[model samples]
Target: MRRARLTFGAFGAVTSIGGFVVALIAACGDDRGGFIQNERAFETEHEGGAPDAETCFLQCSLDGRSIIDSCTGGVVETCADDLACGAAKCQEPCAAAEADRSSNGCDFYFAMPRHYAPSIVSCFATFVVNASNKPATVSLELQGGELDVSRALFRAVPNSTDLEPLEGPIPPGESAILFVADWDPAKPRSVGERVDHTSCPTEAKPALEADFGNFRSGIGDAFRLKSNVPVGVTWMYPYGGAGTHYPTATLVLPVSAWAKEHVVVNGWEATLQGIPVTQIFAAEDDTEVTIIGTKTVSNGDGFTGAAAGIPAKMMLSKGQFAQIAQTEELTGSSVLSNKPTATVGGHECANVPTSAGACDTLAQQIPAFEQWGSEYVGVGYRPRTKNSDEIVWYRMVGGRDGTELEYDPVKPPAAPITLSAGELVLFSARSNDAFVVRSRDAEHPFYLGMHMSGGAGRPPKVPAYGGTGDPEFVNVVPTGQYMSSYSFYADSTFSEHSLVIVRKKTHGDFKDVWLECAGNLPDWKPIDNAGQYEYGRVDLSRQFGPGDSFGDKRCTTGLQRMRSEGAFSATLWGWGAYASYAYPGGMAFRKLVETPLTPVN
Candidate 1:
């Protein structure tokens, strides 16, 4: 995580109609002729694929002039001579023919969350997408519990599995679905036939299954994916209780973005009949993790518990995950790790009060406090039913005891609420309403967790979309953390796809934002504002272009890119009647800034 700082100096220039330009004549006239010659030579030698015409011109003019002024009477030399002398002056260094390539090691740690209930279900699946250009040889190691792991690789056209071992190398752009716990092969076969492969294929495709299995689920269960090339990881709760319960899934963040310290658990709604649990994992072995929670609790399965009034410290080796189940709503609890650690927070199963729908689990990996923001805009899927209301839980962490926070659209808008570190406040509205939140002081940044309801449901209606109205847990990335561009993969099965965009309201009423789907741009709509923040929603499903799909498939599983001229953060929300999930639109690594590297416990 490195922050780059750039400084620019002003240069006055005079231009003629013929395009001739002059500036700083008094200071630059002495060696102007030599400068022009040196500049031309430098450009001829090093201007291979200039970044831009303006940059090239500026470099040639400023750097050439500086060199001439410094090296008066120096003879002009060719690029070859400059290379030998190593004295070529230019705005940018010459491009290297064989530039050093940074190594993105194959080692990756994935934090797996507990399914509906470890005791009731043991089935869990992990999908790995090899997004890199080169093939990847991957190995899996499970921690915290012993569960049989099965792997199946899927490739495009002829979708054959090369008689090679399941642990064999995965071709570039291909994907492998690993089923852990008790899985019934019959279920996958029932949904789609599996073809035997003579060799690994080149293209990639998505695999659908009816029921993977009903095996034992474990808390703090984790797996390490060591690959020769960089890959993307996604965890799937396929179908809990074999379709009796709604399914949910999330995109896994790379380990490089993991942080050493986090304001642990986010908002928990115990009123929803579901229990809130948080799973934490360490990336390195012998990692010391200190847990401070709201109350004392007992450890279940491979999880460790902490006592109230006194923080509990535990040592976790690499790949180890700890599940902390809290009976009471847990917010503001802190988890400080000596080594980088990852965390997932949400309920095993929950229902939004007053929102119609059966309880479904909602969980999201909690971003570290270092990524906390002072501003956020709340958004959600359309209401499942007209009677059902949408709710956004605003949990603030890292603030003083009396830190005041404000919100919009709540009416004479009750007075600002005072919250201390780890405290939470709630706001409710129609599913279509948008709202904004900001802290009184930007210096004291705070984090926000947005929980959207699965919506009110009617039996047999299935809500049109899958998960019909499954609850969604998305950790809102702050506006300050937004990136200008992003590339990501959408869930292949999700029937509805929408992107929630939030921009600083102060930036003006409108800013150009584009969603490039399979190379086509689509129009997006703006929503009514709350305060200090503007909102926009893009329906990717409805905007898919001709090439956005395959043969008959309208939405294929592939990379989708987005860009914005102004600062803004976006979250991709996808759901069907059966389940729903949301993830930040941009890569987490892009938001990272260089910080202290802490040692393991």
Candidate 2:
């Protein structure tokens, strides 16, 4: 399966026969205009043949037009006008190019969380270039569980023996970086301390040697990234110091768009800074999940409990993940799965309500529940100093058992809050106003979460407004999952980025969208209770490039391709001095499949 043949060069024009020898001596006294001008120059040289010589000039132009039509005895046809130009120039579709078979392959699943300190959990899997002209050959596979390279450890940066060829063709639009995996918590040491390998740091030295020896602590492990086309998978979790770093990254959705039900939650947790975990995997095999909420089960040790009440049932197997550490606030919790499953809520260093500062470890990767949405438009997060006050927590989960909500500045704790199906309710808004959550009963669909307001660093002065800021988690893209097109990637070391869009507010005003990027566009703004709801914000730190600025280069990292005419749903939000993250630049509506050519009638 290694064939690379590309050659094309054909140019011949030696027609200097002295003006075609006086027009072929006046067409040999006019033998039907020199046999129709040499049969129109042999059908223009078989119509510029050359695909392996066009099957030998289409069998010599169908045996020279069948020997000039049976010896031309009955020449009532000037060779039948070159037999329709030799069957339209030597016909040959090659059986539809050998029955075209399309599918340039592209499977995905990524997760690497686990390491709140001694540091080392790097994982890169970039692959931009959403083809506009081919050139993509990416391959990656690291299935889950059982890699026991005999009590392994980890590090991989340019070293490999197995992890299946990753770095690939990736040309067309450009973007490629595959250094998957590098977890060096100082190499399995707890005895006498000290197991140097140069103490693991030379910018994390040429990694690619993992071995958490069956790794599985706080649910963090799942890998799969096959690609031959359709790419764009991101991952990053660097910076593990000062209570285990605070850098984050996202944009890896493609388990064929996973979805088998999910409602999971986590956005406000800060006992002394964090604790709200969640992690569920399972791409097949047995699957059978089921985890209602309000946790409370301990001894069995699946990862402690108590996020609401209780309801658990398990059976994962395919790359298993399961981590669930709750402290009460999983928002109506529900996870039902039977096949596709992939969740990843956050917090192990939260502090959003504890006055946003200090603790930092928020995650994201939850978007199923049939893509929840009954209309949502909450935007919040823009106050690191301006008199400081940018908190906006709002959780709502109820897909049955009574559901009913309708807010729009109705400042509540009111309006039929009778949940049940998955039950969850939490709402807040410290002023940076912009809210809405309609859903009388759109078949009982409801799911909205948006928490952003966690200052960072100097906290502990604790009083009421809670220190100031550092907690982050953004997930509110449901206007029925708006997405008129998108192609994300933006977390260039966080220094403060933004992109909260959210749309829907026609006739009465508020529906003017725009956000191109790289080519530049940006200009949305419209949130202020102007009727149906519409919000905007952009800022992308000078337009792109940062996450180390795509060193190896390829599509130039400025990856953002948006579109609009109405439908909207962005959400990118990086953070400043203390680090932050948020993702989901689009969702719902997927249909791309067009690579079967062979019908040149």
For this target, which candidate reaches the highest TM-score against the unseen true structure?
Answer: 1
What's model 1's TM-score? Answer: 0.63
Error of 1 at 496 (Å): 2.8
lDDT of each: 0.46, 0.45
For candidate 2, report its TM-score: 0.27
RMSD of 1: 13.9
- lDDT digits (tens) for residues 433-468 of candidate 1: 666555554434566656655445434422322245
lDDT of 1 at 558: 38
Worst 10 residues of 1 by lDDT: 94-103
lDDT tens readout by residue for model 2, 195-298: 21113223323234554432223333466655544444555554221122365555555665566666776655536655676777876678877676645422
